[model samples]
Target: MNMKRLLTVVLAVVLSTAFVIAQEKTVDGPVITFESDSKDFGDIKQGDKVENVFKFENTGKAPLIISNVAATCGCTVPSWPKEPIAPGKKAEIKVSFNSAGKMGKQNSVVRIYSNASEPIEKVSLISNVLPK
Candidate 1:
């Protein structure tokens, strides 16, 4: 009788451990994952206008809301989504750079503000400008 009771207790412990291990761990909150954070516009002529898109996805469990996008200077302009991005959805920020009256080796950074696991993110545009 003692042997059977010991066997049942061990089986119960094994089943309890298996049930706990099988439970899923859910992550709570929004996460922004960018495909690429920076783009290089190599060897461009002065007075040239260029643009690049920085694509990102919401990888977390909650919605991602992008409130604003700010550029380092007026020479660089950024446009982004104004609505909430659902989880598993993709979005982009379009940055336009004007090399007019500018010189060589420009790094334009745009700041992204949103309600995510990370509140702020950055993307940059790089170019080596040659005078016309």
Candidate 2:
């Protein structure tokens, strides 16, 4: 009877440990929430440089790490935070579009690479360049 009780206790402890491990593994990482993903510069003169700031927050359990920020074209430049954004903290991505050679309805894309729930997030910049 004592041997059976010991085996049962051991099995219960093992099962409890496995359940805890599974729960921890199921926990998710960081989540990124953006205030606005698209920005419109409206009507702008040619050769004018327009800029916009995209704000975001990390709303998850773990820290947010941004690996890279890239623009679709050279005319569009993006700058993002270098360090990790702690959970519940905010960050901004600065995007600039030079309308020097671009004309008409211009649309630019910026891609953000991160360890958030969504690995890649894209933002857009739009503008209408008027003649100088």
Write the residue-wise lDDT of candidate 2 on 59-113 in tens digits. Answer: 8889999999999999999999999999999999999999998789999999999
The numbered model that scores best in TM-score is 1
Q: What is the TM-score of each candidate against the true structure?
A: 0.79, 0.78
Which segments of candidate 1 are over 4 A away from where they belong? 1-27
Candidate 2 whole-model C-alpha lDDT, 0 to 1: 0.93
Lowest lDDT block of 10, candidate 2: 19-28
In order of listing, the candidates' clash counts read: 0, 0
Distance from true location, Cα of 95 in model 2, Å: 0.6
